[model samples]
Target: LFAIAFALLRKYPTNEEEDFDRLIDNWSRREQPLFIERALPAVTPNNDEPPPDYHSEENLLVFNQAIADYLVTSGYTVSCKEFCREANISINDSADKKDQLEKKWTSVIRLQKKVMDLELKLQEALQEATVGGPTREKRSPGEWIPRPPEKFELRGHRDTVTHVVFHPTFDVIASASEDATIKIWDYESGEHERTLKGHTAPVQDIAFDHTGKWLLSCSADMSIRLWDFQTYQCIKTMHGHDHNVSSVTFTPSGDHIISSSRDKTIKIWEVSTTFCIKTLTGHREWVRMVRVYQDGTLIASASVDHTIRIWSLPSGECKSELRGHENVVECIAWANDSAGPYISEPIANGGTEVCSFLVLQVVCW
Candidate 1:
């Protein structure tokens, strides 16, 4: 009878093995006679009467009571009907109770999935907000977007303007034109302040000194002119190019100026002496534009030969030659010292379309 009760305890799953063992021990002490009469008939050999019914109402009552006592001792406050259902026992109202339990479990699982989905959506919304949200300008399919309107126009040039430059330290601007003049203007008010006239031919390019006190202009008349910007007077005229002077720029130190010409040469001149200090000659065609490094250590020139040459300043030695443009390289501009430099050239087959290339590094020879 004890072995049969132990086997019955091992067959059922409970929260803890020790709790079940304690339950069996309590049952043995409280219902020893009931267990012996109900569970030992199968193993008794000489009994002539039929074995007691295992499913009798009296046996069922004893089983339910035993489970109720175990739950109370284990600190569980479940009702008798709940404990019977947990043990898989069939009672009068068990089917309805089982249906209700199944519905409740299904609802809980569905609600948990919905909560996870909502959490995911909320995370995505927060990420979008942190990343500055969607773009403000949305274009429709096949719509033609127009370019932004110009802020203001300066209209003092009587002919096609060759170049325009802003003073480094002031609100003044200077513009060169084919009308044989350079016009200085108050850029903030769009008022033409003065017209500088010295070149017999069209002025090609203009530049301002580092101190913004002087200006330089090169012209097709084969001469470079330095002007006092404050007094609007030509201070010095430099004549060295055999052909048209195309471009000119002052060095960052304001002690020298560099000029390029259709004669295929670049001349570095002393600002005070007005004498050519060095001449860089390597381009096979006309040099179009020239720019100096901020530290006055390097100079770069663009040419009609479809190449750009980097030269060491004051040494006149070519450091490197950059060649990839299909047409004449026309302009070069440098960003801040940390941002590198770029050059622009017109494409050979594309009308009026220009392509810019970045100058990554210059290796000295």
Candidate 2:
């Protein structure tokens, strides 16, 4: 009986202008219930006599009334008794049975409403995916081109900005200036953040350690000061250079520092002990800049003597001198992390020093 009622609910005609008598006759023939007492023995527990055939007028009225009750609850304009009269069926069932059927139909309608809501959500999800499309992997490479356009400028320094280095893991930049200060700025927004003011003279260079916990700066006052990145305080100061300290950088391991000066010497200092470990001397003029190889095995120094010298770490030995530039070599850097071969390659012009430098790659600006 419930299955026939469900079928009537699903296939009920919607057009009010259609023939109601024809719709009733079609549903009566197509959705006739089975033998209720025999098929559902539990429903007729009190009845000892067998019920009439499912097609009999009495049982048919029960089925028709169930349909009329469901349709009326679902917003049909006609009444249950009126629908029964139009279909020529008598309403002999008790009011209690009608209430029970009404409760069951209410539950079915609630479940049907929930099903419709879920289907609408599924369709919305599919449409969103189709419109947004797939996403790129996290490690995918971005666009690469030479001489890219500048995005923005950081313009807070009062004097000439000598050197700038990006924080290893933060969206900030540290810049040294001739105004005797090191300024920090938000790299993404180009906003001034803070300044370190311990240096007494012009600040020549600044570098952040590998962990970005400390900042090192060299000054014309012949001092190299280490500042805590978080507290912005000068934690340690080293004063061994006889002339102006020109450049400073931390080794890859962050345990030592390499600095060059107008004193024409490169000094390596132990970070923990605050002591000068080794000093490399070869340049006849002021050393302009110094950069350590990525592997921490070698150091490159540019000098006003028109030469670039490669020094071996820990041993304080000048390995080779690169020459041929007629003017002072103001700056020097390893072309790539694997630039050892290019620096060590013997020139074909019978010169002991590397005369020609080959650029393997450009890692950053």
Highest TM-score: give the candidate number: 1
lDDT tens readout by residue for model 2, 167-240: 99999999999999999999789789998898889999999999999999999999999999999999999999
Model 2 has how many clashing residue pairs?
0
lDDT string for model 1 (1-365, tens) is: 23333554455545554565675576567555553454335644356776567778766655555554444444444343455665566454332333442343356446546665886899968654534333336534333333235335788778989999999998888999999999988877888888999899999999998789999999999999999987989999999999999999999999999999999999999998999988889999999989997778888888999888888896789878877777877777655676444434343455332222243452333
TM-score of each: 0.56, 0.55
Ten contiguous residues minimizing lDDT sum, candidate 2: 356-365
Residue-level lDDT for 160 in candidate 2:
94
lDDT for predicted candidate 2 compared with the true structure:
0.74
Supply the TM-score for candidate 1: 0.56
Clash pairs, model 1 backbone = none
Give the Å shift of residue 6 in candidate 1. 87
